[model samples]
Target: MTRAEGRPLRADAQRNRDKILSAAVRVFAEDGLSAHLERIAKEAGVGSGTLYRNFPTREVLIEAAYRNELAKLCDAAPQLLESMPPKQALRAWMGHFIDYATAKLGMAEALRALVESGVDPYVRSKEMMLDALASLLEAGAQAGTIRADISATDMFAALTGIALASGKPEQREQAERLLDLTLDGLRTSPR
Candidate 1:
């Protein structure tokens, strides 16, 4: 089949692509860049040929895996809102962000390869994250549960800092405590 730029994949091809990406994330998280593509294909129940057909190179696979995780994180905003109160939803999403940061750290080497190859995986990460957070925060503010003065950008920066600081296993407890403190600051004070 001819490769068309930005063309939608056929149904079965789309399923294969999804399987490969899911397998890649698991393998890369467990084994990093040293994880074999053939093994990923095996896990996805596809042949190595199919894996290569979907991802031409390891870097491509890595980028797709990272993007897939980001998509999951971004997609959770609405789901969380539907399941919990606005403030609780934002808190739960923050916890998920922490988990995402941890997983991303596990895939650091692969991410570095993307950077060396001139791809900026973080290009729109902040904007998308901020938009998601802004929606939740705005909802909370409307309910009078969250402070109105805090900007989504500032909240994101703070969360990123907390993620970075608590990235290490040894600092996990401290990081959690810090997260609570930050959340406390965001809460509306009783009059």
Candidate 2:
């Protein structure tokens, strides 16, 4: 596990870290803060010592899980752009945002507890989300498929509103319909 300055982690160490994060996400999603570290270690197929070596406390693990999910959502922008048209990419990302919001809502209690304990688990979350949305909007603007007047901040706020209003299971269909309406508003007008 040795490295030079800012060198990347070795393959095995990286794999172990990824496993631990994945296990933590599942455990936290299913059992919240009360999820056992030993269970996460077992699920990751790693030893309990390894889990402790990576995440010293429950808060650390929860924070890491939250960050990992955010990173994955952010990272999807490039892949989406590569695989689909700019407008399609934006639409797909909106769908992912819904999933992200859903998961976060599910973890609300634990997250609030972490915040109450003086830990800012949401550090850089807004910036990261804005950046991701910016990428999608930039692509759409360049493609002439979306209006240039709308800022990423505007879209972000709209998405957040949609998430909050449609967060319940019974409201998911309505939320998606609202998303489509929002996307329609962002589209360029025909001559």
Say which candidate scores most in lDDT.
2
Candidate 2 lDDT tens digits, 99-118: 78877876777788899999
TM-score of each: 0.82, 0.85
* Total residue pair clashes for candidate 2: 0
lDDT (Cα) of model 1: 0.84
Off by over 4 Å in 2: 1-7, 168-175
Off by over 4 Å in 1: 1-16, 168-177
Supply the TM-score for candidate 1: 0.82
lDDT of each: 0.84, 0.87
Candidate 1: lDDT of 12?
Answer: 86
